[model samples]
Target: MRDAHYEWRCKAITPIWTGDAYQKNGRMIPSGLLGSVRWWFEVLVRGMGGPACDPTDPDSRCPDKHGNRCVVCELFGCTGWARRLQFKIVDSNGQPVQAAIVKDQEFVFHFTPLRPILDEEWALLDLTLRLIADYGAIGGRTVFKPSDERRRENMPQHKDYGLIEITSWPDIKVEERQLRSYLKQSHWRNMDHGDYAWASLDNFWCANGKHLARQNKDDSNFNRVLGRDERKTCKICGDIHDPPNKCPKNNRYPHRHSENLINKNRTNQWIAGDKQESKKVFSFRHPQRTFGFVNPEVIDFSEMKKRLRKAWPDLKDDEFHQGSDLLNDLIRSPGGAP
Candidate 1:
């Protein structure tokens, strides 16, 4: 009876934290505190390489603009990892070109000798790999048949196939030493390479259902990629998402701009055109991209102590009414010191 009833058991539900303050068994904690902790862990992984990569090195997207570029960001930008890697090369004659199969996706392969490829050539390979991975098998599609003639008749024709035929592949561990070496060599290059940088830098992607477009709520124009105006676009009011300025209506900006969709159905007094408030009726949000802003020097403990000393004539660090732990925690968090 127990064995039979086990199949009828309901799967446990994991409650999502929405960052609301709540009491858990009498101890107060934010509703999403667990998620917030997970988010911080991910940011640490993305900004500074996790234990796999060097934790001491800064991986935050909000790097010292003048300082080193992040290593975690670089690895993330290197294209997401694929489960089954395969490669193939087809010539103009639709025959397999004899070359080493260095790397492979479902249908495509990077040649061993590093075939001279222009940007267009790489794009063609990229597009072809996308199609094959979505549809075809690694080496090539095979159709089993009773006869040789039947097999030839049914098998999909392709130039040729090279097979690495990996089995029991180990997961690539984060290489902290390699990551450090890579960062040291390429730190200068990382400074200005954010044009193609993806959401791994900022948690902007979390605001959406992990959709790139949905995450970028400040973008006024959807089609433009590298345009100077590219920023996060808010869905509700259709305005660029910025910071430091509240919406004209003075509503508390949603934690993630994506949450504003919930407010869409609610009648907005700002939108209803209350004539007396018409001047303030038009609402706008801040842009997601950091505008041209100078970096202020990081305030160290000694500097903080000096300022506090002047204010209190002698207020000790621990004697302050509020704990400095919260401020210190914010400083260490990935979004980078507030």
Candidate 2:
């Protein structure tokens, strides 16, 4: 680890509930932990263009081509490729850690590189370590908001973020460290992060979004991402709405300019005498997250855009940025370090 020709070893300690449950040797194994961490890593150096695979799909293997595997397979592994790094889940005593049940348990693991960790790889590892520390979850069903949450039951949603312990990491700089920390554990996953919607039930960001522009008879007033808040806007009205203002349209949908962060009672339908039922709706609703559900759910970016329109419409936008645009800027910005 400290030398170039010898292998390097690092340790990770879980601070909250994790969903990595690869059952092997009578213990819950976490074979994909490295791979998961590598994803966030790839997003950092390579920008957004990576493999188009489902990512979480077990069958999602890198295509055999000249660079289809990208940074992931090069650091990890794939068919006809040997993993540059290897890891084993173990206990605090440094023995292989085991879990009889998936939830309510904790484990530790050691990451060892087959060779000296490259500077780029170290950059990835360093960024990931700091992220998990602040965001608060790992493996699956990880990431707790409010930063101080002690359990997954207290978290509003399970995300790609988590809290892990590693002591030997080198110093790095990130100006958006606080924001990235929030993003790693953010509820943005409840919104659409891609083009296709996952389970519609998990789309809670739509609950607070009651803007009638999308359902208004004037087809020109649909929502668009604009402004500092990166919130929604009425393309027809050309005016920013906020603080839960009501739209003048009689489309049965009430436009609440301000987004509701924790209201589970908000509905996607406006009950103005059942007139908006067939409203070509794409709004999300807030329902209680099913307790003890560990598997991650995927949501599309359209729903996310809706939520952004309601919360912060004036945020900046670039030509290409997945999920949140400011997030893309954060990665490229120089002041994000703690």
Leading candidate by TM-score: 2
Worst 10 residues of 1 by lDDT: 1-10
Model 1, 1-338: lDDT tens per residue? 01110000011011111212342122212222222222232333333322212223344342344543233323222223211112323333434533322234211122321223222222222222222222111221111111112223223221122212221111122223443343355343334323122112121111101001112233322112111223334434555434554454435552334323223221222222133322101100111111000101222234333433432354444442211232233233332222
Off by over 4 Å in 1: 1-108, 113-175, 190-198, 201-338
Best candidate according to lDDT: 2
Residue 41 lDDT (model 1):
29
For model 2, the superposed segments whose C-alpha errors exceed 4 Å read 1-27, 45-61, 91-93, 100-109, 143-162, 165-338
Cα lDDT of model 2 by residue, 1-338, tens digit: 23332211233333333343352324344655555565545444322222223344444445433435534555666667677766766654677755522332344445667866555454455554444332223453343211112343234342212334443444434344443343344221122224212211122122221222222221212222211111234333535443355445532234333221122222222211123221222221121110110102322445444434453465334311242333343345332343
Model 2 lDDT-worst window of ten? 286-295
Error of 2 at 262 (Å): 17
